[model samples]
Target: MSTTSLTDRLGSLLMAPVHLLMRIIDIPLRAVQKAAGIGGMAAVFLAPNMLIFGIFVLLPLVINFVYSMTGGTAFFISERNFVGAEQYQRLFTCTNYLDPMSCQEDAFWTAVGNTFWFVVLQVTLMIGVSLITALILNRDLAARSFWRAVFFFPVLLSPVVVGLIWKWILQRQGLLNFGLYQFGIEPYTWLTDRNWTFIATIGVSIWAHMGLYTLILLAGLQAIPKDLYEAAEMDGTKPERVFRRITLPLLAPNLLVVVVLALIKAVQIFDEVYVLTGGGPGTSTLYLTQYIYETGFASTLRNPGLAAAASILMGLVLVVLTLIQLGVGQRSEKKGKR
Candidate 1:
């Protein structure tokens, strides 16, 4: 061999030990995998993702539960005194359970009251308006795609942005007020007053979120067999009768989904309301989430234990609500089957 070629060949040989070490390691892995079979392979592949979920999701939930059972301003679990259910009891303590003024944590009860109204109003209007929008869009309307995008655009905007945009327009001396002034109507306190603020938040919420739920209902509307509508048309069924007899029955599942999801969102609602009103004029818009946040993070008395307890209670209420809804849905399905 030529000297240069021989030198190059010797340099390539230096990698042999590294390659051999990898091969040695891979041999046992391959053997174990082959012996363990397909289930083992799946387990191996899934281990990383499962570990991530355990660390991020499960671990935080466990820690929150632990926090709820403890007392003190201490950050560490071991350092905090184990108070059992005292935190929960603190929340439930009241002279008159029905009256928020009688509660130890009056703010929490007030939040609960306000939230109940918000949920009732918001979910009602949301479903009603979204269903109407979906019905309109599902038809051969002019500029259909444009209108759909116009509605869906709000859903894509950040909650903060949605709040800020509405707040600006509705604020004193803002767009609405200016328009009203032009029409010779005196400017009104849109965001400052409790009643008006509640109305504003509910309206903005419906406008912002209706699109996503509209799309959901639209999908459900489309999924109804076109042939069914054609059959109804041929039979000379009135529009309202066709809708009641056919469309609504078929769309009930999506409506349920929309209602349940809207309920949950209304329960956990904070960001938009917080940005818009800061729970304001005087905690009128304060939601359970805001109450929980103030309890844990915002106040000088940062009681994580109490906040955790409140969150846990909120979670329980949601769970119960969901279970009841699911049970009803399942019962209806079984009835339909029969």
Candidate 2:
């Protein structure tokens, strides 16, 4: 046989099994399509994913809500007694909301306070710093790729590793203290002082996670059409005016996403802070996630029900944030159409 004939023969042999398999699959699919119609076929295709989501997401959410309504520390549902809304009541039983010490669940309230402040400060700084970094990276800088990699490198490190590295540097006997000693300054306990420890958590968290946000904003910055900037330059528009009018308006959608995501992540801050501070120095760095973890599993007087209740409350905050994001997005869309 000629070369073309040999190739065609091999191709036929290779595709024979694949064609047979397709034919086998097509029979049932066609039968189902005939039985169900187009919309039903779409639902049939989506059924597996919906089933998986129900099993993993919805089921766990239902179970968690159920657990929040029950009393006792027992891990199993059957061993626990239902005490609906009591755990939430305990959390709310405070002489003053501002004063965590007056709360029945003092630690929970303290965690809430810390989390609220942390979210406010951390999200603000995260957005600001990430925006700055992204803008700089988007410019025609020397070794631009290298600088991008440098900024994003920290994001690749595991949160545990981030905690350990910062811990070693911030510890009294660590490199930071050693450096301070070299400068003839007295070594200070950065991770122990309540104010300093809280500050350190914020700083460390920003350092650890800011890279991802920077990358996000950088992508947004790059996506803006260069033609707009060129046109503005030709019109002798000031750089600030150009940025404010063209860049900011275009980047608003990405900025909105970054803001909401950073807000959620800041509220859920845990792993690195936990490993670094252990919510210590009199619970100064204590956050909601750590409080839940400790309450559910780590505390000597473990209260899974309380933890579940707290988690549900936390989930409600997240839901509110999500709703705000949706509302803002719809408003933006309406403005865009106008």
Candidate 3:
């Protein structure tokens, strides 16, 4: 058989089912369009996507809320006893709201407090570092591509891998301590000490994720109009003044995106912190997600209802935070437009 003939046969075989599937789908779409015009045609195209969203995202959300209302060890929703807001009451029952130790669900409250502080520090540091790096990388520099890749490499690694690698490096006799010892600095406990452990986790989280936000900001920087900069240059504007008057205003939208995304990511932090700290040194680093998992799956009581309730509370916090961030962003954008 000739090569051209074989290639032609292969193409027909590959395209045969594709053409058949399109025909099969097109017939129903055309019939719907003929019967109901634009609305039906739109529905036909949208049905699959809506079905997917409902099955995957909406279904789980409904199920989670259902589970949050129930009590007992039953895996099936129907079998579980509906406890109303008992779990929420348990969560909120506290002598002093400011002091986590006074709460009925002390562990849960501890996790909540820790997570609040973590978000504050992590988001602040992450944005600062990402902004600085993005600024540097946006300018013409030596091996800029190589440097960007180096920074982003950690973001590509699995959360588990990054956690383990950092754990090894931060251990008592780990590579970090080894380096310190070489400089006549005594070994310090990075993971065991309460204060140091938190600082370590926060630092690692910032380091692991900053590159992604940097890329976002860097893209935002690139999209700014060059003519604005050229005009600034012609006016003999100072670098700082140009940045403040032009770059900052234009970059507000992307900066907003980065802030919102980074905030969400910081709030939901679990995998890396879990693998790295295991909520260790007496649950000092236990974030809300880990606390939920440990409550539902790993605790002696196995309270799925409580876990679900905690998760719901966490979701509410995140939603509120997102709304505030978005409101601020919208106002900033409006001001920029003006």
For every candidate structure, what is the RMSD over all alpha carbons to the true structure, in angstroms? Answer: 6.8, 2.3, 3.3
* TM-scores of the candidates in the order shown: 0.87, 0.91, 0.88
Residue 265, model 1: Cα distance from true site in angstroms: 1.3
CA shift at 203, candidate 3, in angstroms? 1.2
Task: Evaluate model 1: give its lDDT.
Answer: 0.91
Candidate lDDT (C-alpha), each: 0.91, 0.93, 0.90
1 or 3, which is superior by TM-score? 3
C-alpha positional error of residue 331 in candidate 1 after TM-score superposition, expressed in Å: 7.4
Q: Order the candidate numbers by lDDT, best to worst.
A: 2, 1, 3
Q: Pick the candidate with the highest TM-score.
A: 2
Model 1 misplaced stretches (Cα beyond 4 Å) = 1-37, 322-338
lDDT of 1 by residue, 1-338 (tens): 59989889787798789889999989987987998897798888788999999999889988999899999987778889999999999999999988998999899899999989999999999999999999999999999999999999999999999889998999997899999999999999888998999888899889889999999999999989999999999999999999999999889888887898889888888888889998988987888999999998888988999999999989888997798679768966886698
- Number of the top-ranking candidate, with lDDT as the measure: 2
lDDT of 2 by residue, 183-237 (tens): 9999999999999999888998899888999998899899888888889999999
- Model 2 gets an lDDT of 0.93
lDDT of 3 by residue, 169-234 (tens): 999989999999999999998899998889888998988998899999999999887898999999
